[model samples]
Target chain A: MSQELKQTPLHALHAELGAKFVPFAGYDMPVQYPAGILKEHIQTRAGAGLFDVSHMGQVRLTAPGADAALERLVPGDIAALSPGEMRYTMFTNDRGGVLDDLMVTRRAGDIFMVVNAGCKTEDLVLLRAALGDAHVEYDEDRALLALQGPGAAAALARHAPGIAGLGFMKAATVAIGGTEAWVSRSGYTGEDGFEISLPGDAAEAVARLLLGEPEVAAVGLGARDSLRLEAGLCLYGNDLTPDITPIEAGLTWTISKRRREAGGFRGDAIIKAQIADGPSRRRVGIKPAGRAPARAHTAVVGPDGAVVGEITSGGFGPSVDGPVAMGYVTRGCAKAGTEIELDIRGKRHAAAVVKLPFTPHRYAK
Target chain B: MSDVRFTKDHEWVRLEGDTATIGISEYAQEQLGDVVFIELPTVGADVEAGGDAAVVESVKAASEVYSPVSGRIIEVNDDLEATPGLVNESAEDEGWFWRMELSDPDELEELMTAKDYKAFLEGLD
Candidate 1:
């Protein structure tokens, strides 16, 4: 039986725009508007796209040593995070597998964290159990919106001035339509953008304000997925699972040098070990030689026709105008330009291991 | 006018003597959204009634298009390989997927007629 689906604050607004609804992460989220995914994907690349990310888990951690407390969970250097700075990291299990990847920001007098929607419940439970002394509060009454693209800053600056001045990975409390909103110069699309966290009641008004801009079009989960895939960003459940480690996922950059040596986070021992001697199987980009897209779970075959890996995330990248995929392959076959085959429905199609970000990242540095 | 038949899987068949032209219905294309790629069976292949005949990939997901009747594939739509969006633009007419020589004419009776298919679609909502 299907469970009851939750709706975000912008659900009605999305409906008004004729969005196609699909069940995602327990929420009845808009997968695409009437413009369709292909056009929406292109629009985002050329201009700005507004996304409703309110279903994601937003929480605030308040305590004197909150930064240090968070360091015990993830491998990122949270202690060195200056105020109004954000870092992308993940919570790992003791077995060196990633529990959930999240974005942590050092806010004024507290630390703000946004986790994946599906893992939010367990993540909150885990955080509460581990950090008993710190006051962990889930921000259920807030809505998060991401405006991403090359033109994102220009469109956002119309309503929230000085947002253009905020450097990448920086966050600040700014005024949007006279309401206080926490704006961050960060996004998952590999585009220069801002994620706005504001009161739920003000969500529709803010969304309309952004959409009213000429450059900003309302984007849904479909275009968002393609854009991120083209940018080589990982989706939580698809790419980063509890069975996958940060090192294997090519997320070694998230583990700072100091964190690598003075390891204190969960799964640090195994992570450090993998860092020393490279991981057996590494995540790499796969570019199918044809138009046929090799979707997730498609077997990656070696030259000898033996199954070497499986596609974690694969789809047609509108920007790249071809089929692009990412999957785990044996280290020997993980090198760029290595030839492989994708077993798509019993038929093997020639594929090559290419560098990630099929479309080069256009983030504002 | 050609006698058109429909299957529960959303595939449509237009019968002309012993030959039949097949394609997904307009409703199917609408539900599938923007079709980016289509993989149809090669010509001269044998297909069974209710068997998987082709694969239609939209930006969101991939769906299997089932053969409505048992037949020998005579010709497959090569145009879909170059411009799959045609399936979205003219799913029933210009975007037909394949042509087959009927091996079992009796199987056509088991499918829904155009009128019956219209009612079936209404009941789906």
Candidate 2:
């Protein structure tokens, strides 16, 4: 027997907008709207685009020792985090592999965490085992929404004035449409914007209010992919995974110096060794030579027919107007401008390893 | 009169005289979503029936374009490179992938006719 899937607050609204709904992360999600992926991507880059990310898991960690309890799971220096500041961190398994990546914010002695929907169940179980005395509460009734793009700040400022003052990687509790919400000055898209966490019941009302702004347009997962691709942000399942380390995924910067030396979190020994010795394979950018797009699992080969690596994420980047991809290549060949070959359909297509991301990220600082 | 035939892989070929123009069916395009990139075979290339001849990529997924019949590629629609969405806009007509000079017309017998293809699509659902 199978359980019925969950629905986001915007499921009915997505239907009314004629969005193409698909199953994702145990919930029915909108993949694209009638305006389509290309237009939606370009629109978000130009103006404000709204996303219903309610499928993400929102949780609160409490008790006097909540901060210390979380530090046992993640590699970040959580105890050092200032109030209102949010940090991107990851949970590691005993083998030093990434269990999940998440955002944790210090909120009035307690900690607020938001993690991937797919990893929430396992994350909670792991947290319980590690911090048996701590209070771990999952707010399943809360909904997450992202209002992103260059115009996002202005549009959101109309409803929540203080949100405009929050810098990137910051969080604040604000009032929007007479309802309370936790707004964070952070986004998956490299754009400067806010992610609002509100009551599930009022999420639709908040979404409608944001969309009423002429500059704000509804964006789906389709556009979200392109935007994050252009931003060089990692998609959890594709770019970062339980088997992949943050260092190998070109995310070494996310690991702090204090955590790297102290080494208290799970998998710290193996992860610290990887940091010291460097990963054998490194993620690099691939620009296809021709019109054909290089897709995931396509072999990345050297000149002498030696398989160097395999593509993890590949697509036609609307912003760059060509085919771009990212894959793990041998560390020596991962340098920018190293010409490689992509085995796309049995024939070798010319490709070159370059610095990611394929497109320049424009985040309003 | 032209006979419309389809392959199980979703490619449709319209045969007129000895020339067969091939493209994916409208239903195929709908399933694939908006096409972002189309890899067309170069003219004068030899292609075998049931062989991989091209690649079609949408924002969501990528699919191989299989040849419905064996032939030499005579012409390909260059417009698809600039506007791949044409495959979704008008898959059967303006979005036709290429025209080939048939190496063996007998291969058409293995393909499904319009009535058979309509039934094939129905069984798929």
Candidate 3:
């Protein structure tokens, strides 16, 4: 095993809390705390849970015409994104395939972006190589922490007043516990929450303060996976790979009407055709019949025992009280009520296509 | 009740005349985390020693529970249907998975005694 795993700003804190540390996205992250996965999942749903996501990359794109330069990569209407608002968008390859899905926010000062931890290095290299001279800055010394659940709003209000009034998808530069932070009302868990981006030096102090609260607990990567799976969010390597297109990932709404009409982004020609004519395969949600959870790479079988599709993500959803899965199926079989079978270890398990997320999102409007 | 024996794969068998009770060892349940599902063999089904006889799924991973000694499955612990966590809570006692009639009493020689199994566990770490 390679002992050269990357460390987060709160690596010591995780160890102090007796967390089961594991390597994730190049960083040595906590897989679970002593509270266990079940308790952590329930705690995040009921109260507030803090997560250290400092490994995710933060970059700014600045050029003579940055909007036009940035539009060359993604299909979303980036120029139209208002100040203090964040948009979820994807970067595409030349073949209309999604390289990665990321959050882009136009700050009062600059055009800030947050990409997946695993793809951040590649994204930076690609962005810089594509722009040539477009002054792009990678803020590698910044740390991100998410305070999520129903109690998140109240928790933020105590430290940073007026943040409670911020609506979903809104971003504001605020001082959290006297530390300068960019607090955005965005999360991957499909819950009401805020992600605080602060200086790496000040991250430990803020995380420690949050952990002192009775309503707040430190959650780990294990519960994070389960929560995002229940929310129908896409994991970069699994759901949004180089071979999968945004259209097939069931993320058509992220593409704006203006961008759809005037194609200027990379792979626009293929993506536009996919939006109009539909992709060969479509992502669909699956509900398994038995307790056996359909895991990733499980083959999807058609009526006559022929392989039709493959599961990208699947697990026992803690909130759904049963097993749920997401996979790519033939276009016609992506309907919400279509019947399918998942071959788990040669046994075909009955399943039905359903609309994600497996659990309803409770974002604050 | 006859003396119990264990396998390196973490299976335990307690012999009672021709019938024997089988379950996963306490250490196996702990390593698997929380038990989510238990797929038991049907009663009266014949199974071979060291053969795959059951499936045990935890929240983290899935494992196969092999028959320590060949036998005919007499009965399954149906409580696992509604309460799979019982295996985690009581791996060696009330959570016994199945009872079976021994196919060959001599096959029990392949299993390790409790004292020997404890020494094996220490060597593993």
Candidate 4:
């Protein structure tokens, strides 16, 4: 029954704005608005676009030595993160497979995390088991919203003063609409943006305050998927499944040099070995010839017609005015300009490996 | 006015003389959101009722448009290759998928008229 689907705090607001709802991650989330995915994606690239990401889980850890404890679960140098700094890392299994990808921010004595919605249940369980129930406090009463694009910083600064001072990957608490929110200068769209974590009751008001800006528009999940795909960012479940490791996903750079030698996190042995010897398969950017987009699970083939990998995320990129995709390819065929083919409905279409960020990233450094 | 009919699959056909103009209904376009690319069926090819006649790709996923009646494709819309959003903006008129020579006008009896289609959509919800 549709009643079983959970609604976010901004659900009524989305419906009022003519959003079409779809079942996603146990939530009745907006897939697109009357402006459509293409327009929303373009609006985000040019101006600012608001996205309600409240379905994602926000977890806080501050009992004691939480950052060090989190290092036991991920390979990133968590201990090195200074206050207000953020890092993108993944939870790995003993087999070196990525459990989930998350953003870790060092707050005043606590560690804040944002994880994928679908993995929240398991991620919370894992965190509590490792960090203890007293330390892992799930902020279930909060909402997460992302404001992205070239004009995002200026538009957001209107409500939250001093937001423009925040650099990329920086985090700080700011007040908006008489409510405090954890604002982070980071987003998955490769645009300068902020991910705001605020109380649920104040979500609609804060969202309205931002939307009042002429340059801001309400974007839905459909544009979010296309924007991230064009930005060459990985999506969990589609791109970073439990069977795929960080190394195979070509996220080795996320594992800093200091963390490699310390090596106390889960799958440290396997991940470090891949860093030194290189993984047999590597995630690479794919540009299919023509306009036909290759979706997830599309078989990737080498010039010899041998199956090399499968596309994990793909769709029409409104910014590039074409299709873009990401998938794991054999190390031999992972180089840029390597000829490849995509098997769609028993027919093969021409494609090639290309450098990532199909559209240039507009993040403010 | 030409006789117009709609299929349960959300496609519409209009008969003017021996030629039948085909396109998806507005209801179908709304479900599809923004169409990024459309593969029009080959001109001069024979198609049967309910057969997959064309491909419509939106930003997130793809859907198939079926031929509502048996016919021979006479002309495919070339404009869609450049601007597929016409389907979303005007799926009934300017966004017509193709024109075909009707092979069986009797097949129209199996479809729903404008009044019947409106009631059909109402019953769906």
lDDT of 4 by residue, A150-199 (tens): 88888888888958589999999898757899999999899999999999
User: Which lDDT tens digits does candidate 3 get at residues A158-179?
Assistant: 8888596788999998888899
Which TM-score value belongs to model 1?
0.99
lDDT of 3 at A217: 97
Separate DockQ for every predicted complex: 0.88, 0.63, 0.43, 0.81
Ranking by TM-score: 1, 4, 2, 3
Q: Weakest 10 consecutive residues, lDDT, candidate 2 chain A?
A: A356-365
**Candidate 3, residue A123: CA error in Å?**
1.5
Q: Write the per-residue lDDT of candidate 1 for residues A306-335, one digit (tens) a residue.
A: 889999999899988888899999988999
Per-residue lDDT over B1-125 for candidate 2, one digit per residue giving the tens place of the 0 to 100 score: 79999999999999998899999999899888879888899899999999988889998778889999999999999999889989999999999999999999999999999899899999996
Fnat per model, in the order shown:
0.77, 0.64, 0.14, 0.82
Off by over 4 Å in 1: none
The TM-scores of all predictions, comma-separated, are: 0.99, 0.93, 0.92, 0.97
lDDT of 2 by residue, A40-64 (tens): 8888878989999999999888877
For candidate 3, give the lDDT of residue A344.
89
Q: Give fnat for candidate 4.
A: 0.82
Best by TM-score: 1
Superposing every Cα of model 3 onto the true structure, what RMSD results?
Answer: 2.4
lDDT at A60 for candidate 4? 94
Residue pairs with clashing backbones, model 3: none
